[model samples]
Target: MITPGQKIIQEWYKVKEWRQFPFQQEMEATYLAGYSGLLNAPTGSGKTFALFLPFLADFINKHPDYKTRKNNGLQMIWLTPLRALTNDIKKAMQEVCDDLQIPWKIATRTGDTSAAEKAALKKKLPEVLLTTPESLHLMLAQKEYPKIFQTLQVAVIDEWHELLGTKRGVQVELGLSRLKNLTPTLSKGEGANEQVVKDKVPRFYTTDALNWNANIDNAKQNRRQPTEAENVLWQFLRGKKIGYKFRRQHLVLRYIPDFICIEKKLIVEVDGGYHNDAEQQELDKYRENELIAQGYTIVRFTNNEVLTNPDNVLSKIKQILETKSNSLPEG
Candidate 1:
């Protein structure tokens, strides 16, 4: 079964006569689930639609009367590494909005944008704004700029790999930091005046009710139908047999690892044969990096390794738990 967002994407694909790829479907589902992760695919693999269509589907799902909606300021911001690419992205996105009858305003604010146009944009922000990192900084410098992005539902950094480990990449990070701080305003007497502090990096949350419930259902299903390797490993990890309680098919943030010991912040994953594929490897690496960034130590084993040598895997996990326990400060 697919989501309404997935169904909408399928209809758009039908218009283009293009078959939707599994990765694209997963990306849309993950986005709608309020999770953030990297999409590492080869060039010219419809990466743009894999990212952009979800934004549109999410909006439509949230606003049943989107055709009549007006003055929705800056629903999305697309930051590209090259100013030249901004125009192409804007045209593509604008065409889709027109086709869907979304009634969204798409505009570009780059180094080449005229001063008069910039002044006009300042007066009324578009629903979608595509700009470079430098222009984003310039926008940040403007007075009351947060108001322009207060309604923002999504932010995309295009060509992120190219911008990594460079001065421009640092600029993008700084610009995004400022943008993430601009959250929706609460009404008076509803914690409106309270200051809520956050970390520099964005945290994952199941922001939508439908998506949250779906994830809960998935986690429950996974627990019920445990893989052979997962069941083998769980034999030793369960019931505090390893001196620490482990949860099977546990949901952490937006990910469901095979097993997780909360006290040790350790996650164990048992991968099947499909994990050997190049594309799956890239996705696994990205997922691991995201988990590591959240301060979790991960240990992975192949299905064969877990099934054939459960004792070895158990010993390794025991050693990790002992080390982690010893390293903890006195409490």
Candidate 2:
């Protein structure tokens, strides 16, 4: 019999044209089980892929007509906390969509998106709208723009841990609750609050995750009749859960980005606390010189600068994403 995990992989292999790991299986389980919880995992854990896979599978099964129009309209909204991460992630997501022959297009709409580009994006509404929390809030605030996001079946928030405790997080949770209210009866939490957070401010919980999982199961099929390939998937997943998993495979998959400058044709390195130490400072200086030697306009900011005045942070990042809206890579 195909284990539930194996069954998930079978589905992915057929639909996503991609392989599955334990993480992806769990994502399918949670999504299929009807749970809408933040996926708390390390970067490079294929977190975005995990969340997007189910949606992509559903999109192909549901909307096969996008191939004719190619790269158009508001289908999926991927929210990232930082504008700096937008281009690279968007490029990656779009490339995957291309490989799947899914004609969905993604655009970034943030404080960084130029006025002209933002206007054009609104006019076109790329199929996948990868944007920031602030930009999404802008879309939701418009009295006449509810339809812009009404078709959004799945909203994946990237770098969620950084957002879970902020005002932005509150906006997302409330927005999610609103979306659930419209689409399904999931997230039936009566906007519960303790004496302090009676206002239904942002938060997360293990119980919430469990309850949510129970619901994503609403749309998924039970793992009863998986094929032979699915049976192999089940055993593989069982081994994974038991800690007899892939040796060093996980470590090798980590992602390391070459820095980008959002201003002055520059790549900025806003330091975290780790770089404040003397040895770390020396190391950073060496790295900076190396980048500069390679014709990169590298700049650094104190961790304090990022923590205290992020207006300063936005000031630096605004330029890179302001690139022409038509500035897509050659296909």
Candidate 3:
């Protein structure tokens, strides 16, 4: 019989046109089996999803109405070395939640986050929070730290290798130690009762064990090659052509954009003949909805438009960028 977690995975793969890699499947199975250990996979090899999906599936299986449930403290905490990665991870996780129709909230508590956001977090925590080691230590120092982490089910440490043998790494260890003590029910070696198991310490996962070389190789294999239209648009937008840094074949959640300008929150898709098919159009619509939910402005151009009417395509992109830039609050 297929488990609830497996069913969710099957649906996700079908929607995304993705096949689970060997290591991803192994990690997912291990997580569902209620085992916790280091996950060794290449970066961008879907490690985040492998660790996140099964845990989410289990949560949903136990609480089918989790979307309607009130905030009950944080359910997951993600740690990473750089603050910049926080938003990227948040988008990825948020995409999954949105796709699954789960109402789980996600937030970031980094040094750069505003004071207002931090204050709000203290009153009620989001379901998932992406934070740095130092920020996590600060949270632990709060008077109600125990209450804050009472519902936490998992804690993922990204780029564990960078933290392993450093002072910050030691800080993470100390923080986890205190979190374990405060939430004894969730710690490992707990009793066999279901309630006891639920209260056990949050499962810990790290990328330290991943083979760097293998990760680089896998990234190469998965990288999307630009199409003719995409290549043409890149020539005009490459190297800050429009006064903004545009990334080509940028990965946003499960979909890779043909061109993305992060600063302008813009996504450009260069379409070919296949994009006009009814089924592909449905998939494209779904993809666009996801991006729009993330507050991105999407612009699409056909292969002929980019190749034949290149100037018009560039003008339209420039107009969107300027319009968005004008709406931003001045520094």
Candidate 4:
């Protein structure tokens, strides 16, 4: 049986001709299981959706009448390290929400936002707000800060490694502490909800168990065996290639790439003859565009190239990885 989250994901894949990656499914399951931990995945690995999708599924399931619910309070807060990333996150989330027909609103609050925009957000809060740590701290300073976050369901810290071991990271910690205090009833391990669970079936586990199990089953259904072309490329890209780790048959959101180097945010797709079909080419374009939106540098090679001129393919990949490494910000 397909679960509600899987159903929604299927619809998304149908529209995009994509498949969800294994790590994304695991993240969704972990979130639904009521566990919070650091997501150490590289950029362009669909971490945003991994966190966002479960929250969306839970919100929709719990509040079927979310459209009728009061939209005065914030629902989720996404904190990113760079102000430039705010718009990218907002656009990506809005696209998903629109695709799912969820009437949630998304906005950004960063150092670069206009005063007028900030004032409007103050009056009517969006359901999802993407902001930087400094901007978040500023919001916490406001008199109505607690009320603003009263309805917040989740807080996603993006590019966490960039902020770790810094004063800004400490500020985020303090802000979360304050949010916890304001919503004592919603505190992680507080209150008397155990009695309600005890009154239910004796063998029942948390709803997380149901979600996790459903996701596991859904992943099995989506898994596919690699093609001969994919098999060839995997042999070359797998393990360590020039000191960087590469994953084969890796999943990103709703599509699998033949080869991916997470550190460089690079994806290599080995295409077969069928990819030349008009419809198939169209679908491939859609897939590549979506991946590019997540900051991935996509490279494509024909099956012939991978099987015959393998050295050229390896050289091309090595050059791209080296270029990306040199462009990385100095620590």
Candidate 5:
């Protein structure tokens, strides 16, 4: 079904006196389907519009009153392989934003981008950031970078064919890995199921296989080799530092959570990059449903969150604990 967002895009095209291309429509459909893919066409075949307008559609659909809404954090990252292309790309994107009065702040962060501009981004990120692969790595390298990307809905890598198989391509891959870790839903294509099965299910399987002995073994292994994120959070929770004892890699029914406070019935999960995959997300949903059904409160944090901003993570957990405590029955 064509979404209200798609319909809005259709209206925009009519207003601009432009005809929609078949590929553009396909791209919109794919995007609305919650899948990612590489779009290929000639340099000037309205390729940018194909991807970008759909994003606008999605945004409009989500926030119908977007015009008056407060500035949201970065929602999109446009990674072009070449620094020279930033201006043209930004102009094209900005035109759409301007024409629609979308109030989106589109900025470039290439080698040529100024220090003042970079500093400004740290203070308040734009709605869309256009940058090179190298610049993207720089953003990823910054402390507490995960917060900037928490609201990121999409990362569009332009000219994938140009970057593929080169060293720059590898940089893009590495950078995307970090971004995907922060925003797991920003991913593409198959082979995820295999990775999910081999890497994820063994440690925290959530299916109806009530193999308590196997789960116990898995929990032990996980606790022994806690992920960096899990380990960092554990240090705070270990000695009842937050006024409640927490067990690491504790078994909860048919699943294993990173940390659990039995007294508060709270489960804190630290998700790795693998959890971002579509199949693993489904598994996570199932796992969370099961936990919630059993009177457990689940709070999840990405690996980047725990590693980069542990204090913020701690504060949030403490807040949850306080709220849960306040709701307790009278003695």
Candidate 6:
């Protein structure tokens, strides 16, 4: 059986649409910050590739060393909120994996996926599994689903706005929050402090966790130590902290992250001219307080700030990351 790592390595450069992305550097940077959010661009804009490519690459390289048995749990999963788009996204990722000459496996299980295929996926887990929110809920309902998600390192939910104000969105929020509690890397409870995530952030960071040199492994005695910033991270961040991640952001069909940062357990939103009306502003404040009361450190970014001087926008984000890291103790 060809591994996903092998398939992607061979096909990485061959995907026709791969050459069209120029801003992908930014997208990939955000992905590495451990922030799970949207790509926020229109369809046919190569947004999906912007989000999935680096992730597939990273998954292939990392798994060879860390790959566990199917019983170890899913390493990554994609929840689209839309059942119809599941097949399209899965095919796109599979193509990228194939072109990279790496052995990569991805499967789609929506309401549309036949019982046979779903059963097969359960037996032989794929490197990347794409499905919808409801489908994910179905997976969660299974007797063995908890074990399945034991190794989950990332969950990319597409079209977040679709679910931002709806009941389905609530379900996903609850589900991901439960998963967050289970993840080894995050603080499971609502008690996490913001100051920690801000202070410990490393500068000139990675755009995509997937793009690290595959030859280097973190387990190496010397490898664990942070290297000189310029030597390792120059390719990803273009001076300062313009890093990124291949993140997916879809809302409407079933998601909308109007109020949450899944990784940091913080909720941040950017308000702009589109929402300057008194009613909207009041509503915004209300939501911010609601998230705050829920123990989230809600940060608001003005629209002009995000568009006019994005450096300020990025800096604010850097501070948030640092604050989050610092809040954790030196254990």
Instruction: Kindly list the per-residue Cα lDDT of model 3 for residues 120-168, writing each as its tens digit.
Output: 9999899999998767867765666767887877778888998764434
Q: lDDT by residue for model 1 over 224-278, one digit each (tens)?
A: 7777888888888889987898999777765668899888889999987746644
Candidate 6 local lDDT, 165-186, one digit each (tens):
4434555664565455444433
Q: Considering lDDT, where higher is better, how would the candidates rank from best to worst?
A: 5, 1, 3, 4, 6, 2
lDDT of 2: 0.53
- Model 2 RMSD in Å is 21.2
Candidate 5 ranges beyond 4 A from true positions: 187-331
Is 2 or 4 the stronger prediction by lDDT?
4
lDDT against true structure, model 5: 0.77
The deviation in Å at residue 26 for candidate 2 is: 2.1
What are the models' TM-scores? Answer: 0.56, 0.49, 0.57, 0.56, 0.57, 0.49
Give candidate 4 misplaced runs (Cα > 4 Å).
67-72, 184-186, 189-331
**Candidate 5: pairs in clash:** none
1-331, model 4: which lDDT tens digit per residue? 4457656765786788877888878876776666676777777888888888878876766666755665647888998877777888889889988888778789998767788998999899999999877677567656677678777767888888876644345446655655654553234542222333323422221223433344333333323455566667677766795677887655565445667787788988787774664434544676687788878899999989988898999899899988885424468
For candidate 2, report its TM-score: 0.49
lDDT of 5 by residue, 202-257 (tens): 22112223245545655676667766777788989998999988898787775677
The true-versus-predicted C-alpha distance at residue 153 of model 3, in Å, is: 1.1
lDDT of 2 by residue, 46-117 (tens): 777788766565455445563565644466778776778889888878877776666677778876677799
* Model 3 error, position 58 (Å): 1.1
Q: Clashing residue pairs in candidate 4, if any?
A: 18-254, 19-254, 19-255, 20-254
Backbone clash pairs for candidate 1 read: none
Candidate 2 vs candidate 5: the TM-score winner is 5
